[model samples]
Target chain A: MKQRFLKAAAIILWLLIWQILAMIINKELLLPSPYITIKTLISKMSESSFYIALLYSLFRIIIGFLIAVVFAFILGVISGLSKNAEILLSPLITVIRSTPVMSFIILAIIWFSYNLAPLAVNIIMCFPPIYDNVVKGITNTDRKLLDMAKVYDIRPLKIFKGIYLGSVKPFLAAGMNTALGLAFRVAVAAEVLANPKYGIGTKLLQAKYNLETAEVFAWTFMILLLSYLFEYIFKIIIESRRYNAQTRKSDKVI
Target chain B: MLRLENLTKSYNDNYIFKDFSMVIEKNRITCLLGKSGSGKTTLLNVLSSITDEFKVKYSDFEKLRYSYIFQEPRLLEWYTVYKNLQFVLDNTHMSKQAIHEKIMDSLKMVEMEKYADYYPYQLSGGMAQRVSIARAFVKDFDVLLMDEPFKGLDPTQKEDITDRFLKMWRENRKTVIYVTHDLDEALYMAYDIHVLGEHPTKILYTSRNAYKMNDTERENERDKIWQILRSQI
Candidate 1:
């Protein structure tokens, strides 16, 4: 517990250094101090536009993350189940993984509705990571255990419940953690480029054009805060699931 | 009714078995006696029909169910004890009551009943092996294959498990093909013993050893088998 206090002190020291650097620079457009950023954030809290922009983009990004999770899991399962399917899907996943985020965001702007481009970009950003992790998880499942289940004529449902789900959980947790960060970053980029009217990205763009550098810093901090908030909550959910992930009991099916 | 005839296994010009054949008699304990690399595990794998490198042929078997207790426990590290038992139960008709009773019985047989809720990580090497035995016996297979199941056990634990195993087998009646390098173990448990010999393995020696002695006399015979085996192995 004392160790945690030291770590907290270390973080504050770094923040202080940042604040000092910002003050010496004395150019809000270039860098705002933590104080200015926090003040702007507190003032923005009273405005309904802040809530609208925040919730609207949060909702879309979460949807995008969920869609990526579902599709990645399906494609991962397909490839894991068949070597031929992996060979077929390999190039597509590679292309998605290697492509620049900005390129996808720009392409999505022209290809999709203003509201949907963020989802599209976020999905493109997320699927490859989740899919790769899940595939690796499936591949690493114990061969001996599978053989035992096979010889026993264990039902497919029971095999999945007892072996597959438990095997893939760590991978799923890791993938979700990774994809969450990427999804939020890409969604905001997509929103700014596509200029979705009520998104945090649109507010960022408005601040940029108006030279309200403090507001820009505030919005950026809010994005960081928002991402951290969602992750902390979801982490609890994910970790709670992890604690029981190995609590396997077979399904009774003849 | 498991039969292996002229079954051969080779890995990159290294042959473990060459025309090695054995009829694993039904409802009886068969032990294989030999040194390491004597194709003991290879023969067992062939008999189980899961030999990856072996060219196997079986005559008088039709879709036989086989469960194996590996040399290591091979328990899935992420699962609990009861879940591991459930993973291989072939019979779905056992009532919740019957299932619990049998689960308790099997775990009790191995003295692992208390650790039913423990994960594999929490078990000692001996305890894990016991769970593996429970899991293998729990699955109601026609044949139970054990590969050095008593490898790491201390003397008292080994004798205790072997005794409980015999009692259970007498009641359950499984075709158990047990492989052990220890001849003492073979003499004490098996009705028939087939010795797997040098590379390009063939039947070195095969004999029927009837069990007709008192407990102490049987154990004394085990020591003789051990003395003879130590020189040969």
Candidate 2:
């Protein structure tokens, strides 16, 4: 309770500073007050176009993220198991990690239609972290436990499920958490550049062109709120899964 | 008999065993009592085929199945005690009902039946070791390789676990190659004790405890084994 109150106070203090700065500037275009920005956000929420743009960006980004997860898992396992595969893919992963997100967005816009550019950018940006984490998790499985499995002549499927999956889960969770945040930021940036037909980024760019600074702030706040809410939901899901596993009761022996 | 004949192993030209030939009688508890770095674990690893670095001329032990109890409990942290046992048994051809019966029976034998639902991290060290013992016995194997499974416990806990292990072994007699550096552990558990020396490892002394001995005889045997181990240093 105390921590929550302190956090609320800190946020209020920052908003107060913003309000004072806006009053001193005395130009709405130069700096909008927090109240005006919030009012614009509320008005946007009443428009059907707002939901359309929000859903368009949300679906594209989330679908791209899920696709990246699948590809990363398959390639990560291959890289983990074979030295030749790791060597073969090392340079490509390195290039992807080193290149800027804006560069990918530009290339994606040139190579594909504007509708597909943001998704392409999201997938390209999210793959490396998830892949690296999966490989690390696989390589770090306990040697002793693996030796025990071998001695017992455990089936290959069982070892993969019980040992490999068990070790990889935490790493995968962390990787996805990081990639999910990056997904939203890169998706919006890509949309702004590509000028997608219905997206928050397109509306944001329009607001910028019209000198509607309060609307720009409102759109930016919406993206921030969506990103925070999605990440929070993901964390709650992972935590609940772990809690359920830990507290599961044994079945009665007949 | 299970024989390891003319077995040689070296790592980076540091020979752990050279032309080592040993015979293990069937259905007997043979303890390999050696100081650390004396290749006891290496020998077990060779027999289990965990390491393929050894060159063995001939061995008929490949037809047998094995269950190993390592120094640590090595229970899967994600699994409960029952599930750990179930994991091994699930690979066998046993019916699900039979597997459950076997798991419960083994857990009861180890006095860990009440902890069937507990995860490994939730158990005490002694309790975890007992669960490991249950996991080993629940598996179908022709031979049991125990590599100092009771090394780090307090004396009382060690004695108690050893007694429980012996009780289970009495009911189900399997060929067991027990490895340990502790003298009392060898005396208390082995039918045949092989005292080993390091640096191109080989057995220095072998004793058979087939007949029950009085305290004086046991003490003399302990001293003789202790002297042999001391000489290796």
Global lDDT of each candidate: 0.81, 0.89
- Check candidate 1 and list the clashing pairs: none
| Residue-wise C-alpha lDDT for candidate 1, range A50-119, written one tens digit per residue | 9999998998889999999999998897787788999999999989988888889888988988888888
Estimated TM-score for each candidate? 0.90, 0.96
Residue lDDT tens for model 2, A20-134: 9999997889899999999999999999999999999999889999999999988988887787999999999999999988899999999999999999999988999999999
Interface RMSD of the predictions, in order shown? Answer: 9.4, 6.0
Error of model 1, residue A167, in angstroms: 2.0
Runs in model 2 deviating more than 4 A are A245-254
Q: lDDT value for candidate 2?
A: 0.89
* DockQ by candidate, in order: 0.36, 0.44
Model 1 steric clash total: 0
In the range B1-233, model 2's lDDT, one tens digit per residue, is 88878888999889988888888878889999999999999988888878777888888667679999999999888778899998887545778788889999999999999989887777888889999999999988999999999987898999999999999998878899999999898899988888888678888888886327678888999999999999888
Please give, as one word, the docking class of candidate 2: acceptable
